[model samples]
Target chain A: MASMTMIPADCSSSTAATTRLLPMSCHKGKALHFSRWVSLSNRLTASSFPSLSFKARASSPLISAKIVIENAAKVIDGKEVAKQIRKEIAVEISRMKDAIGVVPGLAVILVGDRKDSATYVCNKKKACEAVGINSFEVHVPENSTEQELLDSISKFNEDPSVHGILVQLPLPSHMNEEKILNAVGIEKDVDGFHPLNIGRLAMRGREPLFVPCTPKGCIELLHRYGIEIKGKRAVVIGRSNIVGMPAALLLQREDATVTIVHSRTKNPEDIIKQADIVISAVGQANMVRGSWLKPGAVVIDVGINPVEDAESPRGYRLIGDVCYEEAIEVASAVTPVPGGVGPMTIAMLLSNTLSSAKRVHNFR
Target chain B: MASMTMIPADCSSSTAATTRLLPMSCHKGKALHFSRWVSLSNRLTASSFPSLSFKARASSPLISAKIVIENAAKVIDGKEVAKQIRKEIAVEISRMKDAIGVVPGLAVILVGDRKDSATYVCNKKKACEAVGINSFEVHVPENSTEQELLDSISKFNEDPSVHGILVQLPLPSHMNEEKILNAVGIEKDVDGFHPLNIGRLAMRGREPLFVPCTPKGCIELLHRYGIEIKGKRAVVIGRSNIVGMPAALLLQREDATVTIVHSRTKNPEDIIKQADIVISAVGQANMVRGSWLKPGAVVIDVGINPVEDAESPRGYRLIGDVCYEEAIEVASAVTPVPGGVGPMTIAMLLSNTLSSAKRVHNFR
Candidate 1:
């Protein structure tokens, strides 16, 4: 017999539950509503045990517990949090400018005409402007050589006004990503993609000049939400150099006992269920189900995957690695896909730029 | 009623069971005998569940199963493995020299008069000689300035003959260890302690010029013994920069799902039981016991700790982080302390030096 149990509605059990649940009328609340609406309409036909979709749910009693929704997860308002961070960064930039007569500057180099990359660059520039930081933009043609890209990076490396340098990723398949990323000066590497910065992040008692923006944003969200990381069991799914890897390092640095589950990891659901915190960045939509979560676990979904959505004007809509409806019922708090990590990345870039400028000018 | 289960004596169950168990009369057998003698006389009074020493064993049914030992774990003879590795390295060195007229050179800088450091340096020098490699030794006074040490490192860094430069650890407390270590050029950092090298090691698709000796030795043992790593669940019992961290990274690179259990971890025994491979590097003697292990798990005990031993010549004897007597009864294969990881470290150092020289000379 398949046994079913009710998921407790209690949120007070989680340390992260201290975060105030956002009102349904707010921007974050709208994200939750939209996520659920899409999930209910499109994915309702799938099994409730999405994490166990590969296995027969009846065989694994552990993941067979039926989720009875009474209270939804506290929607972590990354949009609201990013806004607050930007305001704080703006204040710091103004204070530094007033004291040292210098403003923080961010330089972004975009290669090719990929629509998504262009959109990301535009958002970052707007974010810098709103935060009172100088923004420099460069566009290289798709056919440009790797040396040309390196040349642009070299110019920005020497620019005294450029406190941060970012080269938008997926630079034409012909370009060597490693060589180009290495060309940015460590001091000016606001993206924190340098191997040196990553090494420092992994080592104990060593500090990276700048942490990668997306992972930094993820940690910042945990901090602002008062999610306890110390002595907790953290599971980071995926091992990409940018997000999953750095996020695990950051969590480990914060004293969390971390396990990394990658593509080769067998029975990932078993590992995920052991975590007090789950950060999924595998870029697979709805991979993590409620059955994979430990009760009261705080989830930070870094994957922004697109799934077919015939109801929408566009044929596809963005979703996260976690199943929104399922995770909300099981997790104590969850980050929504669109408004969560997306906004935080730009905010952290601004923060890094401000910090770089402060360090250069010797400002407190 | 307490239930007792007989532990299966089948060595064929574990993938790592392919390693032939050493004869009881060999050097590794002496290690087993000595470990058992000490354990029987001194630690026999303690509970069989040493991993649950802090907990009441009867309270946890999972760990309460009585052990009916029918088979001992396959004793991994690291001394034998290291000897084989040395021969391989010697052959490579000879071939490289014959091919390119270049002999690999390793420079060791010892600052303080620490007895252990001196012993280690002496062992390294002898190992290099045995492998037909040039050895350079520099001894600086305890009262020497940091600048003097840095100057010596600078000379070795620029020396065309020097393939590897190693600064003995625990330099005079007054000198900055980080500053001294960073002085060694990355190319000559056979120790693999440089941040850039570690960063490269951690990132996917990026290769480090060298891997830290001890961790590299651990992996090499598994490879030589034909222990499977891919898709296995590996738990590393420590987070030290040199051994535990790099060991975990190496395991992950080999496609193992790795979790690092540190001092901050809660319920480490629970985590340990889930692992197919256990690498304990924590310096606590006899910390991991029978109850913490999975029946077919392979154990690599990296800790070489000295506990009080009035019965021995030095008034103390060395043991590993794992309780050998208990682990042997429970695990499929286990590496003994003194004869295990100790010899492998120096062999790996020799291998790294040879490789560095090969890279410098463009020798295959």
Candidate 2:
């Protein structure tokens, strides 16, 4: 896998800013909030190689990288689109609260103390607040028993005030994810990762209560951009349940001929090259090169990996599973790592919470 | 669709009657099940097509379909395969009862009374008895309340003796199928049509407790016949929740690049012709013409339709969704109607019942 030049952290400028939404006694700056603020600079290799310096160029009037930035940049702009959706949701939330005595509530359980999981939980909470939704955060220790977790679920199930429930993933290895998840009643499964909802989504003539968040975000990007899905050949690289698998089903449901390419799949790039639409969710950073994307193909990169960055104080920067540099030149549109699918997840989660509230209240 | 010929009610000397399994209630005489039965004659049409037949011929002497014979037979013997599965299940049931004081119990609920639904219900009961599985039948009028149905389900759910639950499908339009089916707790969902289970099946890493019966039956035939599934391109027609949808997921789970064609899909025939394996569950008789199949493609037809036939006493003949006459010439292997996927459904249902019992008991 090609590596990117380490970008220097502009830490001096970023002061400790407090976001008023988090009134909780405990919590830090939004952790999982995708911070893929890539800037275009002649300050280039002053950052590392395989250089990621060009990944996220600001939305300027000048379509800079006029030659280098073609497909990857054009394929998608998840951050901008996600921000738009978040704004729309904010309006919707304000309307709900003003018109009806109701506020969407999301209860998230963070089991054990995996740094990544913790970061994800934190970002989710912050994102929840930004949309005017209330978030109930529960931190369970690593040694928590199945019964204890199940008990917490029961509490959430009865808490009519909580409209959606999300158990931050990668629970302790000993924990049975399925059992804990099944404990969440179907009505409040806002993540839409439940088997029942999945089945409905996978099958014909049935709609899931909520599409799986990441995949849902991908489809939303397409819909917002008015990309026609029907009769399109969509190739999804990776087959993870959370992303690849559900993404393929979602695309297929929209009438795309979806071929899911996994680790065992032979010729992933060849398969990808044939696609009119490509969604790379495999966690391999910089794996999909520009050559892999067909010109004019729409791309949704769902990977968020930490890569080494000597210039940044954190010693590393976040990059996507796909190699966006060459990709931007080939694909018609694409989403950047930090700003793309990253922000979309929380936005979708908020949307789902709002939706859960709507359904619970029979708000049509 | 081929027409059915009827011998006089008492004229049991005809070939189909001699070879077909008699109903469990009429099994006073030793009878060969679907697989073991010999095919006296599978020809009812002109001999232009090659590989299709209504039943699997069991005579050792008829090892392979002779070019002449293949040219004549236009059926895919689902009835025969289904018969074999039931006999196999019956033997296993007997063994379980003898060793563990356990008898698989399947409870079926029928609401409102569609004539076709009634016939299916009756057939399921007979199939259960034949397989040595106990059957519990319940009938509710069309006007029954959702609560009343839920109460009955609760009763069944609480009944330790009841191992599986199947609500006969095509319930009154007023009844909410999703609510009713989801009410059947996942553990007792014997038909494997439960949304939760279906969702698991669709997710890449997740496996359902039990695959839906008809789709399971289709796979069973492939397994019994030693058909290779991994790394094959399989096309599934129709997208109905009951069959086409789940069937495609099951196939994809088995490593096939599955492309699903639904009612809204255009150029389905062209899509299907590209498959190494084709499973059509659309329920439209003869909708899939022989020309639609690629040469040497393996076909599993899950459609059991009753087409009008003036010559038969019932004034109708059982036909499949495939154009058997033309398909036989093109397909390397194909399922036959009357005896094809129809029989497998009941066998799988029985198998699912046993599976449910084992799961509930946590029997390894």
Candidate 3:
């Protein structure tokens, strides 16, 4: 294990300026300085020590000593954790089928020919197959009417064999997205994009039948990695319906002191630096720099942006909202771009399908 | 005008201990002390300067000089503001009625005979009358079946003349609150307790046809006063589905960096002292004291609890979760008990009903 480098004394001078600008009289002697590691360490329990997420540190000689000395965050292994969840879902599905002689099923309605949409649909189908759940996909043409899409959703809603229904987003330009989503029966709304499900998610003591997959994946990663969310300060840097907003709501449900920093927010960097955990889904690659992060922050990056990479075989490579190179040094733990939330999304969809099946069939 | 009292130097020692206990290295040199008035004075605008809501100050010259010299918060006059909004609503209702031959109507379905519930319903009916919106009432016996209540809601849902429907909360234990609330049509859900409306409120860029009244009133208070929510740190002290949860969500929509402090939260006072604004809805009398407030912080007390008072004619008096005496000296602005959020809730309910009517009739 590498001995961690101490944070330089002048790292928090910018925050000192912000403190001066605040109207509250209590804004002095509490601006965060990286030099105060002693008090920080005292506040954390042994289980929550930043080094726990670094399981690959010993085996991966690719990790540089300089980065390691700079307090490299433990890499939250989302790929591995997602695989574990899929295995559990498979077992549950198998047990339910054996007990009731019925297999779980998912129905996907994808409109238009967007490359990204097709790829996502294909991935979902493959994932359902991997877990032995039946997949029913309806691919309407790009020029299809809203009525045609609603009819397909109606068919899935009425079919007892299909326990889950998902309408792929970025629907055709002419169609009303809300109308189409609301058309899906609440029981079959495994995508959890329906307003009712989201409402249930927002209310205390009320559980949504399904949580939106991507945000659920983010929380699942934290849970799988044994990170404590309750009482911790969390900053979510986006307010998108599918990811950022739901992510913030879910964090609040888990009792994290959650703050959302969107496009209109001022002093975002200053706010982000105060979080014990940071979830960035702003879709702007490398928007979160090293300075934006509090030292020892656990970061879950949900943004997957494509950046030009001439060296790669493909025309471009995916980069997350977080500046990985910069964040890895300051954070206590981080989830990588491609492998972090992406795999977990598919896993959650499968889990939702399994749960829906169990619920409908009473095969718990 | 009575002189405001100055806060003592040693008022925030507990916060100092909490500042020392934070795990984030960024927590340094920012502990609040009430003695610092000059910096606080520099941050406030003219309209927002303390004393605006202090309507009782002149009449009650008994308000001590020591307390007056201490920074007295700008009093947020919810009663006065609600009155102005009601007047505006009256004008709108008249114009709509004259043009469209239809008056906005609100239906209240009250179950049980609790004195408070009766008073609330009566007040609502009176408010509707004042605004020239027709009022319809349906009172069910406490022993009525869920079906009976549902039947009444269904009738109002189908009534074209009724633009809004509210089922008084704390329905008999035998009835399912969720089931009955869901029975009200989404369009008529002016109380904004419906899952769909709440979901819309939670989603970014999506608008709820109606927002929950209490929370809406809280936001309206801040807006009418020109208190900037965007980029400010706000602490909502509670997570009730009715008030605290939605209030936090609404504040987030306004781009405030919002943190919800609940029962499980650690060092709530310390967390609260950091906020530029604090909204307390925990229902505990005087739980939020002057020491818990950051000097120049804006306080919104949502809790309305009755404490036994031998001197009062009723032998009890209503109080807020915040200790008004202490907070008035520390905050930049504060909403007083009885006249604060109480008046605003009904104002918001009327506003919601009026908006729903206008939306339905295309009167706007």
2 or 3: which has the higher TM-score? Answer: 3
Q: Write the per-residue lDDT of candidate 1 for residues A1-364, one digit (tens) a residue.
A: 0111222222333223322223335434545554554333322221222222223323343334332222345667677778778877888888888888998999999999988889899989988888899999999999999999999999999999999999998889999899999999999999999999998998887889999999999998888766788999999999999999899999999999999999999999999999988999987777787778987788999988766667669666777878766676567778988888888988999999988988888889
In model 3 chain A, where is the ten-residue run with the lowest total lDDT? A18-27
Best by lDDT: 1
lDDT tens digits, residues A218-331, model 3?
Answer: 998788667889888899998888888889889989988887888877778887987888999877777787768877789999877776666669756776778766666668
iRMS, all models: 0.5, 2.2, 1.5
Candidate order, DockQ descending: 1, 3, 2
**Positional deviation of B332 in candidate 2, in angstroms?**
2.4
- Window of ten residues with lowest summed lDDT in model 1 chain B: B1-10
Candidate 3 Cα errors over 4 Å, as ranges: A1-71, B1-71
Please give the interface root mean square deviation for model 1, in Å: 0.5
lDDT (C-alpha) at residue B28 in model 3: 14
Tens-digit lDDT string for candidate 3 (B226-280): 7888878899999988989899889988888788889877788888987888999
- Model 3 chain B: weakest 10-residue lDDT segment is B26-35
